[model samples]
Target: MVNEMKVAFATEEKNGLDSIVSTKFGRVAYFVIVELDNDKKIKDNYIIVNPGGEARSGAAIKAVQKLLEEKVAVVVAGAFGPNALVALDEMNIKHIVLSGVKVSEALGQITDKL
Candidate 1:
């Protein structure tokens, strides 16, 4: 049987796999959720507008909470706020930081590790 997992990418736009990875995790505009099969190939994907992007405070925590609801196994971004990193650690969600890369490239870079 093949194992599958879902990874969420903090993105600057809602352009699916072509979306640029946002530099800031908490204030990102969108979250691209990609499901990967055991072979490290994309099985499915979608996008969600980040509610925490417009928050005045605790945006990182809010973003983490939103991802938790989606049940993502991992998260990818250019950078993670201090609070966001702590939250993700406590929640046991894995995170990868890859700056200035498109969502597709980020996936390619991390495929082997995932």
Candidate 2:
């Protein structure tokens, strides 16, 4: 089940979502967070991400998870490696993969969809 948790949208800039796409370990598609309509409406709440790496799933999840430690939920601009994915799974946080998209545009799209 998803929480009415606060979500984070990764952005390279403080303004709009940037073109930057970096996961801790892999290429980010987008970063987003959903209030979890029982965890099924993730697709509608996910947004684009702005990261600082090439493609490191572990590192990316680590970074995101670090932020998530307090928030409870996150929508990143990309996906995580098997290891990180498992950690999130165990914690019951939905790790939805938003592969290959702009953070700003993705936010608009996902928000509208949601």
Candidate 3:
């Protein structure tokens, strides 16, 4: 049986695999959510607008809540706010920082760590 997990990348645009990693986690425009099999190969992927990006306050916390709802095992971004990092840690979700790269590149670099 194959165990599957989800990894979400905070992205600047909704360009699928080519989406650029966002510089800030809380205010990202979108999230490129990828599903990976036990072999750490991508099984599926999709994008969603970040509601937190439109928030007036506590964007980082709101972003973390959205990730939790998506059942993400790992989150990738250029940087995370202190609140976001702490929330992810408390939720037992792993986070990786890979800035100035496409989602595809980020995935390649992180697969081995999964």
- Per-candidate clashes come to 0, 25, 0
> Each prediction's TM-score against the native?
0.94, 0.47, 0.95
Q: Which residue pairs in candidate 3 collide?
A: none
Candidate 2 lDDT over 15-81, as tens digits, reads: 3345443443333333444344544344344443434244454555554554455465545545467
- Global lDDT scores for all candidate models: 0.89, 0.48, 0.90
Top-down lDDT ranking: 3, 1, 2
Candidate 1 clashing pairs, residues 3+ apart or interchain: none
Candidate 3's residue-wise lDDT over 17-90, tens digit each? Answer: 99888888988889999999888888999998888899998888888888899999999998988888898999
| Candidate 3 whole-model C-alpha lDDT, 0 to 1 | 0.90
Distance from true position, residue 12, model 1, in Å? 1.3
Model 1 spans > 4 angstroms off: none
Point to the candidate with the largest TM-score.
Answer: 3
